[model samples]
Target: MTKTIIFDFGNVFINLDIEGAIKHTFNSFKIDALSEEMTAFNSFYEQGLISTKEFIEFYVENFPNISKEEIIDIWNFMLKDFPKHRLEFLKQLKATSKYKLILLSNTNELHIDSIKKTIPFYDEFKNYFDAFYLSHEINLRKPNKDIFDFVLTENKLIANECLFIDDNEDNCKTSKFLGIKTWHINPKTEDITNLFKLKSELFN
Candidate 1:
């Protein structure tokens, strides 16, 4: 029986223009593509290995033409809207007290701060979760076995009894390999509000 539901924040709840963000970054930074070191630096930031000040400084030093304000705006451009119906669905699910609701997302400080500022019910949404694990806060990220292990161990949750839902295929794969049930949700055609109807078999 599924006793817990683990959710990914981006795409699963809030809409993110990942492709557009990448293109925007390339244009703003005047870079054709991100280098290996650049990718690693971003990963480090997401894992909370670097502070926001350090992250901003690194960008400023590398791309001398861009101001800190511009960099921050570009960084937070990917995050879009949080549909009301999704929150309502989550509210209903929380009211049931049927399962342990956990939110596990690979997010950074700047993005989170932007979310809090933009989303009026950000705190309310967070309060619904029994445990909320942000990658930056926890120093862990999805698709890394350590994060999955950490969540399971910390929460005393059985892998088979928990369903991990993420838009990232690799993340879902990792959770599944760890013996957790997973739903690789496609945001374009799927809505999280249709969870029980879409994954009814998991509930049974």
Candidate 2:
């Protein structure tokens, strides 16, 4: 019946460049691809396993030419905009109290602070969710079974009765494997405001 809705915060809400940050890094380092170690460091940082200072230090150590401020700017370049209509949709959805809404986002401290400055209604948007779980804060991340399980157990939600929405295909696949229904949103073609209209069968 989809009594609970799990929402992803990145592309599903705020727009992201996804590759913009990497492109900036590659330009700064004159490298075409990220090293295996570099990828691991980012993953570790996303999981909140590393401190912000240490994460910044890794880049400082690798690219001595770039200042800390420049690194911070490149890292945060992926975040774009948060559409007001989406926030309105979420607010209306919350007001209805039709479902238990949970915001599950794979985000770090810097990105969040950046959004707060750009998105004036950031805190107001948060009030739309019954529970807000940020990966860095929770020490858990998306596409990880443990994080999904934690949300399920904590909310006393049956996976079959929940719907998860994310812009990442891998995340949706993982949630599906855990018995939760999913919508891998296409930001260009689909708007979350039309969720029920788009997935009418789910309601029926």
Count of backbone collisions within predicted model 2: 0
Candidate 2 clash pair list: none
Tens digits of per-residue lDDT for model 2 on 1-204?
879999999888899888777788788778999999998888888889999999999999999998999989989988998999999999999989889999999989889989999999999999889999999998999888899999999999999899999999889999999989989999889989999899866653
lDDT of 1 at 55: 92
lDDT per model, in order? 0.96, 0.91
Off by over 4 Å in 1: none
lDDT of 1: 0.96
For residues 1-204, could you state the per-residue lDDT of candidate 1 as single tens digits? 999999999999999999999999999988899988889889999999999999999999999899999999999999999999999999999999999999999999999999999999999999999999999999999899999999999999999999999999999999999999999999999989999989988875
The numbered model that scores best in lDDT is 1
- Candidate 2 similarity to native, TM-score: 0.97
Worst 10 residues of 2 by lDDT: 195-204
